[model samples]
Target: MQAPQTKEEKQLDISLDELIYKVRELKQSIAGFIYKLENEYQHISWPNMMEHFGVLSSQLNSVKRLLKTSKMPLLRNYVLFPLRLSPDRDLELEKLTEGRVMAFSHEVVPDYLRTKPEPEVEERVQMMSVKASSMAPDTTQKQLTNLNKITANLLDTISVPSASDEREKDSSLKNALPQTSSQQDTNLLIGAITKGHRLLRPEPQSPMVVGPQMGQMQPQMQQQHPHKLQMPGASMGRMPSAIKTNIKAAATSHPYQRP
Candidate 1:
């Protein structure tokens, strides 16, 4: 059986219940603020957003401390069980509360302050673009000037030949032997002189017995003295004596007189 509750216990229970109710109300308020901030985030200021979060954090801390110190087993378990069961709820709550606070403070504040665009910045960008466009013509002119200079240099190089080229032409002219009428006459005179020298030189007499004449005479001689001719062995042995006799006969023969 359960014993009856004391006055102190009843008061503690009542205070714990009040604390729990206050925590619930605070959580609801924070949720409402988060919803409002989500919808109208751009409009809200940083200080206002932070103030709301600070109040909520203080209330939550107060509630947590109260719950921790409470001796009521049912009250503590009832409040802590749901929070412990899903740790994500606390994280989500923190994200909803503090996350928006930081986002609003850092992100939203700067944007809110400078909602209107700066005329000077826009003008500066326009001026830079205009300057770049204007510079293009000057750059093209410079390029054209360089091209003209290069063309002029090329023309000068082609028109005026180098000293080496002039020297080559002069050397070619000097080396070429000219064929003037006087030079041709001199060449003809030298050829005439060479011809006269050749005419003055003594020439060797032609052989009396050529190869073809000797061949023809051999057959005729054989026919004329067929029986008188000695055998090859006797002719070889008596060749010198026969030659001496023929020479003596030719010398004794008469010289022919013209009638």
Candidate 2:
């Protein structure tokens, strides 16, 4: 009911313009598919994704078929010299001639476009280049001044004397220390220690009372500490006026007679 009258034909003699127009249409179709994928992929809900892929695959197949059936297969079986650049150490601009091998290095200008240098000028330049190979050294040198310690021996053996030094120190300490001769020596040591303690003892600093109602208190305190030693002249020099007054009062109250 839809297309019952249509018929299929096959000779397929296509013109170049028509073929190019078909290729452009295929390109447009592929570009439109890419545009949809980039901009409207999230918004579009695809009913059949495979069918759209199949259309693109079919387009690719048609392009392959066209290339395969053409007079020229267009295989890159041989290298075209001008398309790729290769290094040539012997390559010189002045020696370039027609049909000479050329490469796209430094300058890719054609032979006809290159202006030939003068022979005298070229010779002088070559001589100058040859003379000045280099007077300076390379960027780096062998570092002979490194901090690597080189020795004939590696094992460290500690001498017996070094271990004996600590033992010797212990023995020397035992010899240097004084030994107790008898009980008299111990008594003498005790007397010296007691004298040191007596010398280091701080003198008592009693409050001075120079005003009224303190006369009775002073006499009582002096009576209680009558045997208290008097401070030396050197110590009395550092004493305040009140301390001097108190010391004088205590000395006056002392019961010492000029015996």
Candidate 3:
């Protein structure tokens, strides 16, 4: 008998052929997607939603195609994809933190702040301070009184005059000045005599010979006097003879008689 061809080998060969045809189809799809994306991106304005959305759509479609064509379950192997256990872990952590924050917010803090007193106590303190301020110091009052006394004493000292000195000055002026008319006349007569003596009878050392010459010349003066002519009373303006005789007698008795 000839050896039988195994059926398992036949199935393996068909599956392998099917996988190759799927890979070829995937390559063609990827090429068409790349061409379409490139054409749209180049023509599209940058920063537009359509340009970015088209790139993302192309990537997601490529990934789906790779997953569909491949034999391996690649979702289990990719670490960069956000479709794994990371989202569940993040959600669980956020829920736990929120619950903890709410519990803390509801808890109460202790009351440490204090309050002040009433208005009555403040008024009582102010009244006591006012009463204390009204009192005075004994020493300061005494010092002010002493200062006033000293000022009065200084005024008294400056106002008093020297009585005895004033009296002495007045008495001395009285003694020095002339008192009566007779004393003044005597003073005038003495001054006249002093001046006449100075002119007529000089000192012992004088160049003039005055005293004896004046005495000797008196007798010769009588003879020269009779020879000098005298006017008769009748020749004068209406002079009587009796009146002329009286005038001659008065002239002889007078101290100023010439001869």
Candidate 4:
């Protein structure tokens, strides 16, 4: 029988045939190295790496199917060359295995069909019923009332300031008052004394003219006696002396001391 084929078909067949040969060669080389490690480098025998190789074999089979399905020319070559050469034994491979195991347990395994019965929902419902049965229908209202009472008590306790707080507030107010009050009182008393002095002791009316008349009158008025203005025959000199004496007596009579 003659094998009839197109140019594309022949090329495809040739590539596929070459890929199969390379795959077989790669598997043989890998098996030979694994045997050598097991017998000779037994101490460094990577059971884990070997396990990965088994998984890698399965991956290669998957790649074989992919190559057939996709008709990609280069996939087999990429898979084959590395398989023929031994990989370095490293912790990276161990970590990969750990990750794969984790993925299997956490992501892959749980998604697999679960045969175990789930009693959690039923148990939760039953527990809820049991709790419900243990309490009266009015229990929620009673609890609400009790909670309100507790909250009211808590708020009252917080809102009402303690004795210490009140004392501190009062003390703060008292301390603040005296600092401002004493200074204000001193200013008020000084102002009152100045006002009273202006009212009771009016200055002599300024001389109408600003020349010698005022100047002459200023000394005369300063030298003039107070009793002459009010008494019958006292001299201006005696009047001033009496006014000085009377003013000193009046100043001594006042109870308030000068600031």
Candidate 5:
């Protein structure tokens, strides 16, 4: 049988349900706004359209903040919350919220906010149009010529680097990079070599055989070599001839010098 949930787990489930309710409310609010935008304000002017966009934008941000602050991992997984009316509704809500936010930012807001030649903008547009219609063809051509000259002067004033300047910049970057890289490479190589030497270097071998058996061999070794017994903790059995030769060779050899 499955164990019952602790108090904390029960509280967490309650909080998560409350969070889902808030998200659902926000989603309904966005749906209502979209409905109004489509039906009530089918041909909204710039100012009125922006006011609607602002309300929707603020609602979306609040939903985003709610999702962020909830700190509940299960809310992100659609499969976990099967108790809801629609198991996949939370995922759909997230997608709808994101889509609305993007639509407002990209399509509706930018188009409405941009300067357009609207009749309500000012009387200047009408005046300009009337003046353009009354102007002589030769005089218009002269004005166009002057405008082109002014644009060309502006373009000339915007400095662009020459091929030589680009080449110099490329060469300087290339020169600076190699010196630093070479120094770093050399240091790394030396460090690797030093580490290898330290790892491969022979350590002083301790006598493997110890205790009672080793103690028993002391007297026999003393008779064979009396002077050697004077050394402290000296083992009585001399190491095998082959092992002695190998140990001496290892001790004498330098790590850098290959065998």
Candidate 6:
């Protein structure tokens, strides 16, 4: 007689694809239930309403239970506060880390990270930090001073003028200009005199006949003297007298001559 053979175990693992299909089918069933109630309400009697609601409730509960028991859990997002951990901050780190579950897989870690820092190395690091801290202000101050000088040089090069300078320039220009009417006239007269021209006396005409008429003309000459020939009171429209018209001066070497 042969011994009884054992049956093979069925695969029990459910993949994400199977979960998605089941969830999609449940969602479709619930959606179709709502659609049916909305579309067939006029035809549906009051006795079928409770049954329809019951079917909807069962379908929703099935989907909820499936999601709760599935391999993938619901994801919740929250803010992660930034923190820096140091030897002095160990208490805060411990408080943060207390009662926190940790999970990890096999990963390669560098051996250098596992080794503790030597005391001499820590001392050198602290000294270097101190030296850097001491030099920071000096370097920053030097750079700031250099930038200030550069700005000052740029301001000088740009030549931003003041109102006072403009006023001074205007005042100088005004001073250079002629200030008085007399001065302006003098300037115009000088310009005219320098235009290459010279003044000359007028030409002479006929001389006086003083041979016989000297005695008789003495009284008339006294009445109408050379200064009285062009009388200011004479009528401009009147013809000149024969004696005054014929009594013109002769040309002479002398600059002064009588009429």
List the pairs of residues colliding in candidate 6: none
- Relative to the unseen true structure, what is the Cα RMSD of model 2? 31.7
Q: Per-residue lDDT of 1-259 in model 3, one digit per residue for the tens?
A: 2234455445445655665556555556667657766777676565564655676566666556655664533334434322222212344545755543222211211111113345788899889888766657676578789999999998766654343345677675555455545664564456336432112332234537557655644554354232222223113322333544577787877888797
Which regions of candidate 3 deviate over 4 angstroms?
1-5, 43-259
lDDT of 3 at 136: 74
lDDT of 2 by residue, 56-119 (tens): 7888777667667644323444333455444554356325532354544546544434455668
Query: How many clashing pairs per prediction, in order?
Result: 0, 0, 0, 3, 0, 0
What TM-score against the true fold does each predicted structure earn? Answer: 0.26, 0.22, 0.17, 0.21, 0.26, 0.21
Q: Please report, as a residue range, the 10-residue window in candidate 1 with the lowest summed lDDT.
A: 195-204
Cα lDDT tens digits for candidate 1, 1-259: 2335576577667876778688778978888898979998888899988888888888888777766664544552332222122313345545755554333334344454464467898899889898877787879799889999999999887855553466677665544435445664564456336433111212114444255544444654435323233433324433444344575566655366334
Clashes of 1: 0
Can you give the lDDT of residue 31 in candidate 5? 80
lDDT per residue (tens digit) for residues 113-188 in model 6: 2354677888999998988777879797998899999999988766544433556786755555556566645644
lDDT for 86 (candidate 4): 27
Better candidate by TM-score, 4 or 5:
5
Task: Give lDDT for model 5.
Answer: 0.56
Lowest lDDT block of 10, candidate 4? 195-204
When superposed on Cα atoms, how far off is each prediction in RMSD?
A: 43.4, 31.7, 56.0, 29.9, 28.3, 37.0
- List candidate 5 stretches off by more than 4 Å: 1-4, 70-259
**TM-score: model 1 vs. ground truth:** 0.26
Stronger candidate by TM-score (1 vs 4):
1
| Candidate 1 local distance difference test against the native | 0.58
- What are the per-residue Cα lDDT tens digits for candidate 4 across 80-154? 222222233445544855443332223333334344435897788889999978888699779989999999999
Provide the global lDDT of candidate 6 against the true structure.
0.49
